[model samples]
Target chain A: MFSQAKHSSGSGKTREIKEWVRKFASVPEDFAILVTELKCTEPGCPPLETIVALLGSENRKYQQKVHLSIEQIGEIDAKKISEQLQRQLENKEESVERHNEH
Target chain B: MSTSNNKVPVTVLTGFLGSGKTTLLNRILTENHGKRIAVIENEFGEIGIDNALVVSAEEEIFEMNNGCICCTVRGDLIRILGNLMKRRDKFDYILVETTGLADPAPVAQTFFVDDEIQDALELDGIVTLVDTKHVLMHLDSSSECKEQVAFADVILLNKTDLVSEAEIDQLEIRIRSMNAMAKIYRTKDAAIDMESILNIKGFDLEHALAVKPTFLQPDYPFEWAGVFEIDNSHLKITLSEGPDPSMSVSLLNIGEASAEDVTALLDQAVKTFSDKNISLSPGGSIDSTGKLYKLELAQTGSKTFYVKPKKAGKYVLFTQHKPEEFSMTIERNEIEIDAIFSTNYEASHTHDSEVSSVGITSPGDLDEKKFNEWLSKLLREQGTDIFRMKGVLSLAGKSERFVFQGVHMLFDGRPDKPWADEERSNQIVFIGRNLNRKMLVEGFQSCLKKNRQLSIR
Candidate 1:
């Protein structure tokens, strides 16, 4: 693992986070996972955040964010964020099923 | 690769069913008004044209593995354009009439994806026809309707005679808000000057929308700015409940300042809005110490707030919502004081629009290094959300205006015609989804050589 002091913006941290997202989300290695750093100056928006977009096998796009900057994120942070995204994905699946049943 | 001269221009006609696509197609085909046109239409039976020029379009869409997320291209369009190339002298132009329900992206993507098609054919522009009378119903319900309008380079709001002028104006605002860069031509029965619509070179890196002052007043960061010359004594700004439950106001002191000073203050107020606003109870005091103040209204009846200037000769009060909405009045020493200088600013951001246009036409040369950094960062993160952006910019130290346009993140720009006798100014229009005009203006302002970058920290 690269130095945590080496901001998450570095390629090493991005790759590690991508792996954690795939592992937590239960996706294959070839799955599309993108890590982006966004700085939104607008109020209520964190000064710096990490946006992750993961494409599911079924093609449903899942997007989530860690409030901290990439370098600031740890393995625990990534795991928690990924699990939250996974839960979101499951909730959406349940909602879609509910709609189809009706 | 064939030069632009030989490239057969293809214009995509898209709209909901019965929005006068056939009318416009037949008019262009039969008018004998000049250039030989070959049409690739899926709905062949809709038009009565029984000629060599009319070819049936095969609706075959293939998912592209080119890594451009979900990029789908029409297989039939590639085959058709290839066949048309063999019979070189048959036609100079290609018009593809897309089905009302079809997503226009695939058809557009074909030109960009296919190497041979890109060489021989130019994706001229997409023209969407809007059924003005019934569009509001579809606009609220249909994603297809929204996509068609959002993807257009030009729009024709057809059947205008059926709707009132006020209704047309609202529809125009709705459509214009969706695609700011697209030139909207109001029409009845799809009646349009064929010369004006055809061969416009709209998608060409060089060709762009004429920099007319845009009709995007509602999307301004703030709705109103009332300038007043007040003393250190307490002054009252009373408002009888207006539009929204809450209102945001930024009172900035501009003491004995010039027009340029007020302009700088206006930029300051735009950034002030994004800072944590001090939510005040109805009768809370408003300090003119440069900060955003939000006042809660309605339940407490008429909201009367006091403005205690730090030491004010002249102060500009920027309201998120219009002062006119809340019959607002300012009084000093129980005597009303008329604004020595007053101007209304539109600083309200767009609400209820997934796709909106932001037009910035400001005078001044922009610092090149600053502009490059701001724009590169903007396009890098926001390219997927941004559909099309085009502009003519006045770059610092450049005599000529820089002309540029981009699809998604692919931007192309160059030094164009010099600003000879005319005044040097920058005018740009962005047609995209969830575009923040305040951010765009602030970013652009920060790049300018004249004004200090006061909008962003």
Candidate 2:
């Protein structure tokens, strides 16, 4: 059965996840969050995983992936992924500053 | 290269108002295809789709926060499709039905910009439906309608019974002028083979570049051309109003009377159409040997205009409409004479004069670095105007073909399957606004290795 559980177009779980990413990551409204599950079918490829990426308004992207499906992903997973993505953004900015200093 | 073996094939249905997109959707859903098909409907926000797994969503367009103005997409599509992938086992095929008058570029860009969508779903094709009776009006004033036609891979000119056979022919000619590549299917009530529209694999470069020879062929302004042996004496051209009040035409002294000569002048004669029209009343004398002229036959029945050739040898007289439309005739003295060589040409009518298709197919290998530089610069300056472009290119010294496609600025390309036996060539078409054919062809020519055999339209 299709999950017709209290849906408002795209305002359902996808929005919830995006909001979660925004809240936990402490990112601005302009940052674009892309969430998808990439299922690996070939050898040496990453396994079935959930990817959450933050695309900045000024053309910056920081992404994080975990070995879990959407159904298995909880608040803790969202928090950890957001923290990792935030760290990546911070590291990129710090590196840019260091390059500018040089 | 991404594998399409497992990704769900998505077909986007775009159409004008009352083009029967919903009817076709209902029919597809009712058909027992032994496959699970997911329906994404925005049929006026929400449609009553039953049994089939349906998602009622609005068109949410999100501009990619990047600095590029043209980089926008249907945020609703990303969200809906992203959620659908979570339940990937529920459907085998996905159908996205967009409302009429919606800009299809953003919807198309959704698939292009999102990497995961590209991995999970194969953008099978964009299918556009057109109501034969009413499409002309929309095509005339609606930019969105023109974009739908320009971006379509499969165009269904549906509801043929409502319009006459001649009207349908006119519509087909008009649509063909806009898009030289889409497979057009005419049906009464959107009745078409599922195989024809679904799983068309239209985005596949190899299939996309196999453009027919008629693609780059120049569309002449005249609907009918007649080569007649004439002298310095004046010839009487007579016409009667049939449907339209007045008819516009152009005449050329075209030294030779052969069809090949006329064919060669097809590209040359197109410029005459752009000039201001000179109106002639009944029994008016005019010099039409090299210029475009109009016959003003309003309520005045059976008007006659005299054509005095600057010089007399062999001249080709081109008519705007088919000669039979008004029972037109050329008279030398008192007798109505026939043309020695005459043929009817298809009228290439563009609804939006600014937007057009430029098709270039040449037989040569391109300098890879030169081509990359030229294309990058071209897209950088004019990417906002470029709606969509697809091609299969031949790079010099490379055994495999360079297959590529683009939406606005974002492009994806790779060295595709090697050319084992087939002759390598370059075939590309850009559907966009204010595209300079000469500039595109010449730029593409600069990148060619041998610089031999370049043809464009």
Candidate 3:
């Protein structure tokens, strides 16, 4: 049973994902990026999820999650996540600028 | 308006453990001053026993527990102070006694930063009591002790009976050296005159100006400070080895003089550096009358500023901003020469971990829009680390003086009384952790009116 049990272990993949996210997100050097592999207990929630959170000024957080384990995430998934985060950041900047204008 | 809108003076009493702070509090409460006072005791332990000792006194006593007043209990203080304001009719004065290890900056800043607190109460003064017998050991071991001494407007040397007269004199000298503006009083068992401690108006700019002409000058921390000789020839000043990326560099020429007399002139110039009366030139231009000039780079993070003196004479370079590591050298004829001078005034000693106070006094009207934008962004980013900020400013196109101050992110400012017959100037002090004095000074200089001619040379 122990030999058959499946575990999420992908240090190399995780490192690659983080590097790709950092390069595409263009987050400030001071801003921190936190990646976590969380398991959901709720019946309707995804069984396993990978959350990538970018924390920056004014306690702002940008999070993108994939409903899959770290081991399952590949370059294509990382690219998609980075694009989503970049769009979110651009939207945030636009909203902030508009707010300042008003 | 809230009933607390009426300005009730709040006095912060800070001291080390076994420093007779309680005795002084008790005396203030029991003394027949004919004024009702409220006491807020910030106790350290789980149990609140100090209030029990003061239960017999007629003054209203409020206890704040959980942690030191300077840190975790600051919110508790704000809440209690707000509550006390509701019962303002019962008391005419508010006294806050901080725990032994508390830094008084936050406590004093509470009044300035909070809108409700600012309207309800005025910071009368920070009165720090020092135990004559054991304060030296505490001062050497604890940074809190030094900060308490530094932030004090009035320091009472209590327990004088325990120490000899010679020791008391030595202690007073040391305290004065750290904070020259504070009024020092000798007492035994915290027995001080009620008039000396209460309603002192130490924070009142108008009253303080009346007492000491240069009351707004801030004490800075730096390893070395000196005056250097710079002739009409082009000189390349390189700060390649300083700890910080930049340093506050002021160049002032008090006419033709020898290198031997430069130290004495520099001493006089340092006094004028923080003097609120003397006007400063805009954009670091040479002041024609005072003969003082501040050097600043056009861009940030650039350490070198090529100096071509207008006239051949002696110029003083005073470097006392934050840079704990490395040294400075001046390049003459492509040769790196160690900048040499005479006077070596050792600033107040503190570890790199401690918060330091940096004061900048300029004698030019500030552009209001630029100043507000810069200050707001600064507070938003680093307000938590910056414990206290106070400034009396002279804004362009405004006859009234602008007096503003803050604690953490909360800042308050308003047009104070008219300039009257006094000279218009700006004096600002920032007490915080890891403060970049050079950046702050440069940023403030950038806020001056664009037309350099407006500045009085």
Candidate 4:
């Protein structure tokens, strides 16, 4: 099971970890293995073991989340998922700009 | 050197476009026996050859982590070879299918350049497919085609079912003129004896050299000329081997007009080849397809050209260019040279074969002066046929293995550390045409304490 988690207080280390994940995810089938390797190298990234456990946990929210497919997980159709992520990031940038103006 | 008690041979399958290379590749993969095979298909596209169609099980080593492995040409070929070596335990033999318009030289060069690839996989043989119907045309207009034939250890003249006897004969003659060494087979629908394709090792240098006509012979110097006109592209023409070097230079100077004219000539040749339904290659892009004409200039002013065709048969220039215009002097001794070129002026020596090892021993009983004389004569005579030599030889009772190598006229010597297996016998591999094996055997043997025979069978 794969999921995308958004977190604030992102440092250079966190951004670097994300970029590594993106690069690893570019390859087919080996994405999960590469992601797991990256998590070990990542300074403060979430442990892949924790993610796998969470996906199997007995909580209603976790169970419902398990039902959702990882559209962003390097399936060739991830292009659509990337477009949605792009829109969200753009909106967040606009709001930050407005907050700084105020 | 293919398999040392279990090492599988890696065979490279190469040819021009639509030459039935892939068809032969599929037959080998699907029909072969118990050997666990790995297929490396270098295409202009990303997709691999169809698994169900080419091989039943693509599971062993299909996933190459390198982005360039499955696509492009030599760059991808090296990566694929590297990846295959890493996973060598999975397969018994590796078969690489080069792109239709690919040249075998670069791919063959990969085995020698990368030490890791070289150690893991020995270049077993280069199997080139020539489409019978279009081979002549391809040879006439495609430079890549000429290089392919020149580098082949074995040539599969496939699709012979489609052509007439006369056409095939003309094609064989052209192929031989370009590559005197390659074993040509007239196949029907790409069908070939898989065993014959796989087991082929180094070339029979003596055989190749013998087949090459002597352009150095006196009294054959004659002038001949033909104007090749083209509208759009370059004309790929080949001079048969044994061209007297002086005449070749003069002919090249005449043919060497402006780059635009060369392109126009090629375009017209390709147009004609297409009109005749002969194939022209580096096939896809107009810009990518460049024809290289192979010419042999014997020292006697006699010349021959080898044209790799796209559709028509190969062309040979039998006489000199007796110009209707002004004249140029043709000198003799200047004919002994080998040169290759493109419009960008990157013509250097196109052939890259080298004798990577040598063995030498000076007998205790033989007189030093007499031995030196015999060895010197042998070196000179054998040297004429030697392209690149690099190997170590045992010197009689000495513990050291003498290292020696030469490329064309250049030779060098050094001392190498003694091998653990002294019983392995001192051996040397020579890579060139017309090398006299019996003469070399006798010369080296005469210096031996018990007459050691050096036959590279």
The alpha-carbon deviation from the true structure for residue B353 of candidate 2, after best TM-score superposition, in angstroms, is 1.4
Cα RMSD to native, each candidate? 14.0, 11.3, 19.9, 22.8
lDDT of 4 by residue, B1-457 (tens): 2365344577877788788876787677677466667777653423233553122211111111111111111444544454455666777787877776665555654444222344456666788888888876676677667667766768888888898987787677556544544567889878888777885643222121222221111111233323222223334332333312323211212254344434334323332323322222221211111222212333333232222223322122222333221132222233321122223221212222221112232322333344445644444445334443333455556566554433332333444556565363454444444555456556656655565433332
| lDDT (Cα, tens digit) per residue for candidate 1, span B365-417 | 88888887777667656866777777888887888878876655445466778
Choose 2 or 4, whichever is better by DockQ.
2
lDDT by residue (B54-94, candidate 3, tens digit) is: 11111111111111111111444554665676676787888
i-RMS for every candidate: 14.0, 14.2, 24.5, 24.4
Tell how far residue B300 is off in model 3, in angstroms.
46
Which model scores highest in lDDT? Answer: 2
lDDT of 2 by residue, B1-457 (tens): 2235687888999998799999998878877676688898884734445678998657865553222223566666776787788898888999999999888888877775444566677788899999999998898899899889988888999999999999998788677767767889999899998988888888755565654523534565668888877787778988887667877777776757788888766655666766788887788776755577877878657888887777777877777789889988889888899988888886444334667778888888888888887786676678778877878888889898877777676565767788777778998888888889889988999989885766667
Native-vs-model 4 lDDT?
A: 0.42
Candidate 4: where is the Cα deviation over 4 Å? A1-102, B44-73, B203-457
Which CAPRI tier for candidate 3?
incorrect
Candidate 3 — number of clashing residue pairs? 0
What's the C-alpha lDDT at position B307 in model 1?
A: 91
Q: In model 2, where do residues sit more than 4 Å from their true spots?
A: A1-32, A35-102, B1-4, B43-49, B65-69, B210-217, B220-352, B420-423
User: Could you give the TM-score of chain B for each candidate, in order?
Assistant: 0.75, 0.73, 0.59, 0.45
Instruction: For candidate 2, give the docking quality class from DockQ.
Output: incorrect
Return whichever of 3 and 4 wins on TM-score: 3
